[model samples]
Target: MPALDLPFSLLDRSRTRAGEPDAVAVRATVERAHRAEGLGYSRFWVAEHHAVPGIASGSPAVLAAAVAARTHRIRVGSGGVMLPNHVPLVVAEQFAVLESLYPGRIDLGLGRSLGFSAPVREALRTARTDPEKFLRDVAEVRAYLQGRGPVTARPAVAQAPPMFVLASGAGLTLAARAGLPVVVGGPVLRGPAPLAPYRAAFDDGPAAPAHPYVIVSANVMVAATRGAAEELLLPDAWAMAASRATGAYPPLEEAAAVRRRSLTPKQRESVEQFYDQAIYGSPDEVVAELADLVRRTGADEVMLTTSTYDRDELARADAAIARLFTA
Candidate 1:
């Protein structure tokens, strides 16, 4: 057995179920995380998003704190906190306080996007937006975290956690040069082209840990049968496909509801194609597919995330992946 180093984590978008008459979604989210922790998964991360009806992880720091307090061993932190949406000093103060409470277990993954639409982005952005603000902010954040400055973090602030970059495009190049871990992936469908560039850009200099680390979160959903898995995942795949086509955020609620209704022949064809290229399959089949992805990207650690809302399916999927690592 290779030992499961997949270090599965939840990249929660924070949307509740559309029509379920139960309150299990939120509790299930908590329990699902706890189960991953209990299963010896490595890290548990929540993303920072804003103004998306389907996403509740608008506050990664607060959510991270709750998840951290609930679980004991698993590393809990933001898969990212959208940096441009915040002032770096405020970001520093929030995370420093988190680190103080959960020493040696906090991680701060930063992304430059506002993580929302224009209006939402504008609302979240403070009155300051300099062109080189990220660089200046990052430096300030680094200083505040390292206790190297007189304007130290306040309000129960503590040591800063490891910083990472959630990168896409030239963002990878920047992360490497700046000396931070780069998350080469997330919810969107992926292939070798993007991951290769991200790996090549890394430098492993003083800004990063002794060894370079790359974390990629791939979309996956496992069910008892391939048909069932594909059936359940159409909404997520279709939503992404729509986002790709229009460069607009798809209505997730509408997308989810689409699954329960009959689809047009064209839409069905598109969803089927999407499943073929992205994620949709039985557990064993998914393992074979993802192992190939690992070979292509040279990912040091991969976190298989389920964008679908099926807790049992995700659990079964994890067990299947865990078995491979054991094998």
Candidate 2:
């Protein structure tokens, strides 16, 4: 593959592995961030997930602070903070503090994901989320960060931190209108058609650059061989299938154990679909796929979310991917 032009970032969800405690998983995430910084990754972002046994990252802002404290250069941020889960001002304050501590090295990526489950939704004291409300909430959060409203976010600094919107196609348009950079992924990003509208409608704002900036996210895994990478990816695929089969998301299982079990037709289908969406293989192959993806979408940056059950393998994969873009 040709040398990559776009910068690379990592999105670590701190996926909990079988028999591994949440604290261990979170510690591993921070360690991974440190490694990514050493490997020359441009940024390291964490995700927010609640009440899911498989994901240890519950509060992105808190985790962001942790990672930021450990690393000096790489930018740290949320792959997203689900805006509907908390008040807009509180979110702003959390990120405001992050920026104050890190200074010019923090990002605030916001999304409109509803709670992972109905019970989780109730636990958060949030009702069923409305799409319209999510847009309004984004505006409110941005307002607080910019100190545009009468209210001042505590510990205010000279400027608000940069923000990236994680949204669907419609949400992309909203981000464009809001004049913020956007992080978009999935099938829509595989082709040029969907992102055209986002590129056309984007308006330069004070927070982000005048030109539109888009970060494309994907599930990527790289290893010495194609089969080896696929084997590493199987645990997460099976876990996703199990989540669909039994409404209970479990921790990542060992690759051997997951491969030994028999999956129902539906479970098999889910696993296959999840596997198909990801980019996995040798470094050359993975880089080639990412290059094509960037070419199709005109992405300014690529954010890779690599989740595997083995911490050692996960770190190795991170290194291999880093070599692809950073070499």
Candidate 3:
């Protein structure tokens, strides 16, 4: 078998499980980050979501700081921080504090998304929806990080931590033009249209590297058998389909309980589609598929985002995936 040579990282959304308190999910994420460090995973990133019951990580910088405090060596970051929800200076200071305390082990990945829904967006006081504002905000963030603006960000460091832009299509072009690395996944990874433009637009000047950096995010689960793997994936898949059919994104239920519930025809189709697209299998099968993903997408790194009902099984899957690169 070919070695799993591409770098791999963990992206934890801090998914809340059915019947468990949200606090448990948050704490579990930090614990998982510690485990990831010991398992030889490169980076552990937390995501931000608001007005969503299923996700507890509403503040990435705060969670990243918590993870950084617990782990000795693994890089901790936002998978990323949604820029529109935050004041640029505030975002700058929060990360500056993280960098001040943790030094070289922090990453700041920024995205232009307005929270999740219109109500959430309104609650966030998102003033700008224009795409051009995203560019402006990204520039402003870079400025604040480097203390280039009239008001210097507090606890100014000698350097800004490496920055990443999470985007696709035109967003990728914007990232490349700014010389920042772009993280791509979802629909963009499923097709070939977006990446070529990203590479073509890339200049790789002093602001970023000479070559483009691509990170692919995927829903991955691994178990001793294919059936077990599918079972592990079902809870999150069901929650997603439920969210689509009705706007409520509930916490994940147990696999057995989720399987017992009958889905609407539309929801059933959504669930099956999600199951079909996810990467899951025994160790050998997963390793082959993951390598092929890297080959097809030209990903510099692979970021695994797995949500499961069973904590023990989740840890086992994490360990199994880590071994592909380590063993």
Query: What are the per-residue Cα lDDT tens digits for candidate 1 across 213-325?
Result: 67766767766678877766766666655554454435344344776766666666766666665655766776676667666666666665566555565677665555555
Where does candidate 1 stray beyond 4 Å? 1-6, 20-27, 126-132, 155-159, 186-191, 194-203, 239-257, 260-277
**What TM-score does each of the candidates earn?**
0.82, 0.95, 0.95
Model 3's C-alpha root-mean-square deviation from the true structure amounts to: 1.6
Ranking by lDDT: 2, 3, 1
Q: Lowest summed lDDT over 10 consecutive residues: which window, candidate 3?
A: 185-194
The 0-to-1 C-alpha lDDT of every candidate, in the order given, reads 0.66, 0.85, 0.85
- What is candidate 1's CA lDDT for residue 266? 65
Q: Of the candidates numbered 1 and 3, which has the greater lDDT value? A: 3
Sliding window of 10 residues with minimal summed lDDT for model 1:
247-256
lDDT of 3 by residue, 81-141 (tens): 9887877888889999999999999999988877657788789998565667777777787
Clashes of 3: 0
Q: Which regions in candidate 3 have their CA more than 4 angstroms from the true location?
A: 189-193
- What's the true lDDT of residue 95 in model 1? 85
